[model samples]
Target: MFDSLAEKLQATLSDVRSRGTLTEDDVNAAMREIRLALLEADVNFKVVKRFTNAVKERALGSDVIGQLNPGQQVVKIVNDELAELMGGESAELRFSSSPPTVILMAGLQGSGKTTATAKLARLLREQNRSSVAVAACDVYRPAAVEQLITVGARAGADVYERGTDADPVEIAKWARERAEREGKDVLIVDTAGRLHVDENLMKELAEIKRVTNPTNVLLVVDAMTGQDAVNVAEQFAEVVQFDGVVMSKLDGDARGGAALSVKSVTGKPILFASTGEKLDQFERFHPDRMAQRILGMGDVMTLIEKAESQFDETQAKELERKIRKSEFGLDDFLDQLRQVRRLGPLQSLLGMMPGLGGHQLRNLRVDEREFDRIQAIILSMTAEERRNPDIIKGSRRIRIARGSGTNVQAVKALIRQFGQMQRLMKSMQSGKMPDIGALMRQAR
Candidate 1:
């Protein structure tokens, strides 16, 4: 979503970093470029101005102007200011000392409030090891209760609903009581939302808050709405209190203005981001890491965290042993591939690698179906053929290709690539660096 903005900012920073010296004009030029980039990204005008001023002030300060590497200092200043503008650090969800921490979810009707509720419930259950229950207090929209019932179950959280017949406030109150009785670790109240921020919406939300006395009130904002999302958050801040923000639809084609400007406009930190449609794609937002990504510096920590979540330590050790023994068969390869795919889309994962952010990432197109095709080819192979690829003669290869819905050439290419990979692994196991250029030539 930040692709356009990221490209412009990264280009500006690249120019700044190429210089050996610095001038006030240079800093001003960079700030102007940044201001334009943010404006083009639909950022709040006031936020853009404030952010640029901060970056410019620091870039012109004595700490940077006469520094040994002034340009690098300026880049650092921009990165720091950007992080500060979003939120200096990641915000943690406040849990009650008592059982059943209540989290009140508020947002506009189309802001993905109900979906965010389920996603947040799943996140808390996994990360906090909490037994979560979600209250279906959104009785206004058609099928709201049923929607919660379906998604809430998928999230592995108990759904508390009195159906659309019950008052939202009463449902919230009862949910709190039930969660307490059941000794649940958390209870997320999914409240009703309006097409816009209106009096009825605020009043109902206030009533729900009054009844539930939630530990944390989270306002869900659609990142796709850009500046309008920031405006809605500001309006909510004036009438009702919310602890933090959840920026949803973060993977959309929106300019990312909402996620960048909400904290600055409303003084509420973004606690979570819904990056994809899947419930598991939701994650805690880290401002510093986001800032680095925007600046074309890869987020290695987030990459590692995602990898650690998907890869099993014991399985990793076994896989290593298999590679060392030249026993890494196609079955093992398929297992490893499945695990990597579980870490999210291959393109997004590559974007987290060092030196592949910004323009480089924009140009890369990862065909996910290639994974499916590879899996199909591997699955078509018999157990003996998978274990011993040398026995896959011309006729065998033809049969496998036919079974896998591919041509014979595709099958042969895959086998050749696997052979090259095995040779590379053998070299690594023997305490020698593989000849990558030679291996690539062999695969071709």
Candidate 2:
């Protein structure tokens, strides 16, 4: 997630912000450090040069030098230039006028093309489209068709696959026809990938394109490849003439050069970013939010949007009422946990909040085993016990703990923590809570 680059940039900005007034030399020194950081992050040389120049010009402009908070002004300039370095705005998927908008997925081997196909289908499903089908045209790899079928099934989409003997182009044509007959609104063609850019791959993809008449040709680039990703995108664009780019593996230790330089280098906007292996790990690329992330400022708007998308309003309101009344029981806590899980991993969601990035939540690993333990404990509770915890005497607590495969003390500690959290929420709602800083200290 560009952790190294983010650290470097945050340190550089902190130094600049510490200075009450910034002279030309101070700005130059800061820009020099930023240039080094970008280069160390493996950014393209041309992009680095252009970015440094734009940032320097903006920092030295009268608007910044004359501002009351020159440090904030300089950070603002860098953020703006960073956003511009990526696409200035998030790009939309281009749909054709006809039914079955064909989308061709292209990438090198191991770029997660097959998985990205299902992620895209899930994304389209969220848009209220029906009957999204994926066509597996990768006949070279023996298990490629089955792999896509498994992913498509996980995404709740139909998958069309032909055996290795079938020509990929023919499979694509047939898949599209089947989608149309089945009344599918979109058909994604997962084409073959090469170990390296080759003429054979390009020729096959071109034939598939000709047969399917794809509305959008998306090039999936691995963000971990850094500047090499830019070169790959350029080569694919030349051959496939793709409409947009999909940057995958962004949740890994990607230096982020690909995301910043791909669109600028290839003249194609980034349509989506694949953050993880999960089917719901895809997000539309947002230039502004990405700018905030690069600058160590979290993406609050994107975080809120994700919450809104996954949260059931009625359940949320009910929980809110319980919290206000100090009646937040284990059932409500479990419900809240499920809602948060839908928004993605706990650490990732927390990292999107302001001042909560960096190593703030590093020690709190949200592993599946921990979630299972919590669920087991909750399930061990009787219906009456969950509704009214005060009725659970020591014997009942021990019994529940034994049922959940946990010790008695662990069960007692969870009950205490839940009670504290409920009381804290009630106090906050009533405007009687202490400052968050003090509460955090007490929690620690």
Candidate 3:
């Protein structure tokens, strides 16, 4: 998600890791490059200065300067400082002792506030919050209430809307009463957003706050806005005073200045991030894991979490059994492919694995469209052909290609790749990949 910044920072850290020992001058030079990298990534100047100074002070301290692995020590210091700069630990939503803890969503009009409200509801559903209800208080924007209802429905949360004609504050109060009467555990108020923070906007938000008595007020910030987002958060804090930030569109080409600077600049933690447009693509922010990913170390914990959430244990076990027995067919393969697709973008998945540098990722040129193509090809085949791909010769390949609206060569290539994958699966029975030379030959 921190694509540009991660690229620059990973390259800088990779050099440090390659060096056996580091002199003070060496560290200073690296720090200068790091400073420039952060600045180029659009990180705040003040935040960058403070972050570099902290890293330098720790790197030059007794523990690291005389250490046997001084370079590694300095890298560790940077990772720690990066984590500290972006909120040391994850901040979760705090619920009230009373039932129906209210969460008020606030942000600029184009910052993806309503969508984030639905994403939050979806996350709460995963957290065992079944009795969640969303109230649409955004009366200003055209079809704003309808937008919230649609997304809220996708998130599996009941949406309360009194139409766009009703006053937003009364809509909020009415929804609160409805959720309380219905014994809901949580109520999220999607407040209206303005083009910019103004007295009128703040006044309406303040009135909603007074009526709803929200336990948590979350400002959805577009991470792609960079410095302007930090400024918006500061303005909101001065007026409405939100409890945390929900940084949306992390999957975009965001330089990541706001995420690093928001909490430090506005005294509010970033509670969650929306990595993709999917309703289920929301996640709680983890500074340490993000720092690891930024340094090209990968984030296996998040990978595992995605797997746990998307993969069905029974189905996964059956698929594993089929692979072990060499019974994995196009049907099983299609099922597995769909499951992997549920885990979000393929490039993002690969980036989470250890040692996959940004350069390698870029070089891979992994096409997400490949999944759709494979699915189409597999679906075009008959039951027998799918069960036993070996029998699919020239005529069958042509037929499948036409059915899938693809060329014969495309179908042939897919079959060839599938055969290679099956062979690799069979060889993995020994818990190790086949010899590199043999594997390369098979790949060819």
Q: Model 1: which residue pairs collide?
A: none
Best by lDDT: 1
Query: How well does model 2 score by local distance difference test?
Result: 0.78
Best-to-worst order by lDDT is: 1, 3, 2
TM-score list, all predictions: 0.68, 0.67, 0.67
Q: List, residue by residue over 206-310, the lDDT tens digit for candidate 3.
A: 999988889999999999898999999999999887899999988884578888888888989999998888898889999887788787655433444565465
Give the least accurate 10-residue stretch of model 1, judged by summed lDDT.
431-440
lDDT: which is higher, 1 or 3? Answer: 1
Which runs in model 3 stand beyond 4 Å of their true positions?
64-68, 299-444
User: Hey, what RMSD does candidate 2 come out at?
Assistant: 11.8
What is the total number of backbone clashes in candidate 3? Answer: 0
Q: What is candidate 1's local distance difference test score?
A: 0.82
Indicate the worst ten consecutive residues by lDDT in candidate 3: 431-440
